[model samples]
Target: MIIKVPGSLSIGQVAESTGLSVHALRFYEQEGLFVNAVRRGPGGRRLYTQDDVDWLNVCIILRASGMPLTVLRRYAELVREGAGNAQERLALMREHQERVTAEIGRLTESLDLISFKVGVYEDLVDQGDAAVRQCHGPSLPDEARTPDLRHEAMAE
Candidate 1:
């Protein structure tokens, strides 16, 4: 039997809206991830509010962005504590922003290398079977491999 609480969502409803499984929702509550305690409906079933949904969305995005559970929990704790910790919250967000920015920079560099590899393959494809066969031969010795002169140019 499902209990209907006016203006409150059931665990199933919250799960559908947040794209989180019921198990995960339970785990989040167990881990104290919610800014405020989740209320209970009849039969002790969990009842969620729209505000809960909004907070869950924030948590989902932060978690997806690689914020560790401990960090996320700390952020939520600060938020739950109300207006006194804005500076601390700002510091935490700034730290996370720096980490995310550095990660994006590293990923961009990796993508550039991947793009270059793809270009090499595309060129081999255009050069026909002989080039493909030659390219597939035993790996070149370190001394025989062409040095990336781009680094030398960058050092200038």
Candidate 2:
């Protein structure tokens, strides 16, 4: 969906382009998570710019990665303050990156386990293993059930 670059867009345009609800866009603004201040039209209706769309993309990524709103607000505040806090901003991003990396690792491991289980199921189905098909349960040994990476990560 070609986003117009030069002129301001209405709230509806921003919502449609970003795949976010109008209420959610308003919430993001009210929560101070947005970098740009939305301009108001003659009737005090919100008008968004291309910069707002760009910033919302960043916000969507950060939020989806499980970054807390407080952290996002702090990041937004850093941008608003402008200059001289590069180190602080870097640190914040680095910290979130670490968390995202950890989450990715956990998810990857879980996916691997699930894939292995699927393979086992496929093999059993092919072999016509009635017992395995009836059970449809995890093949993990009893001792392997506790304190594994998947359990620990999901418990968090």
Candidate 3:
């Protein structure tokens, strides 16, 4: 049973505080991401406590960090089960940490490639050769004939 807590917040208030849409809050509740049952006021309106808001903030960060809903739900289940599950929780967090670390490595590599391209463009601009390099054709000078950078992906 959900105890009536002092300083209960309405759904709208929770949404505003958490930067989540009301719909997303409902979806999170539906997805079993809340560790405790959501409380309701008279006439069955959903009410929330500061603890709920705090928990949702954690959920927000976890989701922002790319924790999938299933994994989050499992974590919530473990929490709701209560006591004696430290090992499982630790294992779950360790696995997610590994994935996050790997993702950071991948993103770093991608950033390196983007930085290299930026350097190339900056050099072209500095040399005032941007106009010459913009058009790719056989008539261009040898130095400007580096390679066809006219790929569709580079159009952006």
Candidate 4:
């Protein structure tokens, strides 16, 4: 049984609505990231719907947040396979949630550090600290001070 969505969209329309390029959408399809197979129009052009675009937006967020493609593909496969694996899918999501939580923690910590640094700079600027005006100082670089959230997420 095939389920039809509310509105049909061309690849360009999907790309525009989802804020992804046509190439990225095609790459996502080639990467097995789609939960449902896209329908094709005459001449074998890819056709999408609002639901597909919405799902792709979720995929983009998950991918951007450092969820591995393998894990995403597993989730998609379970979804396509349907109801029996609901528990398993939930388990996978829960695990991913844990990882996301940890990443949020790291990011929060990084943000705190940045905020502290910014406050210190503000104080220095207000006080006219001569050292703060110099381009070269003993202060650590921003990248060095903060952990890489993407790497931290993938490490989990």
Highest lDDT scorer: 2
lDDT of candidate 1 over 1-156, digit per residue (tens): 122334899899988888899999999999989998999978999999888888899999898888999999999999999999999999999999998998787566556555655766788789875774322222334453235423322332
lDDT of 4 at 4: 38
lDDT of 1: 0.78
Residue 87 lDDT in candidate 2: 100
Query: Model 4: per-residue lDDT, tens digit, 1-156?
Result: 123346788898887777789999998899887888999999999999777877887787788788899998888788779889989999998999999999887777667655655776787788785645422222445555444543432342
Greater-lDDT candidate between 1 and 2: 2
State which candidate, 1 or 4, has the greater lDDT: 1
TM-score of 3: 0.79
TM-score of each: 0.78, 0.82, 0.79, 0.76
lDDT values, one for every candidate: 0.78, 0.81, 0.79, 0.75
Q: Per-candidate RMSD vs. true structure?
A: 8.1, 4.8, 8.3, 7.8
TM-score of 2: 0.82
The sequence of per-residue lDDT tens digits that candidate 2 reaches over residues 3-103 is 54567889998998888999999999999988878889989999988999988888888898999999999999999899999999999999999999988
Model 3 agreement with the true structure over 22-138: per-residue lDDT tens digits: 999999999999999999999999999988988898888888889999999999999999999999999999999998998887566556546666766786888885344542222
Candidate 4 global CA lDDT score = 0.75
| Residue 48 C-alpha lDDT in model 4 | 92
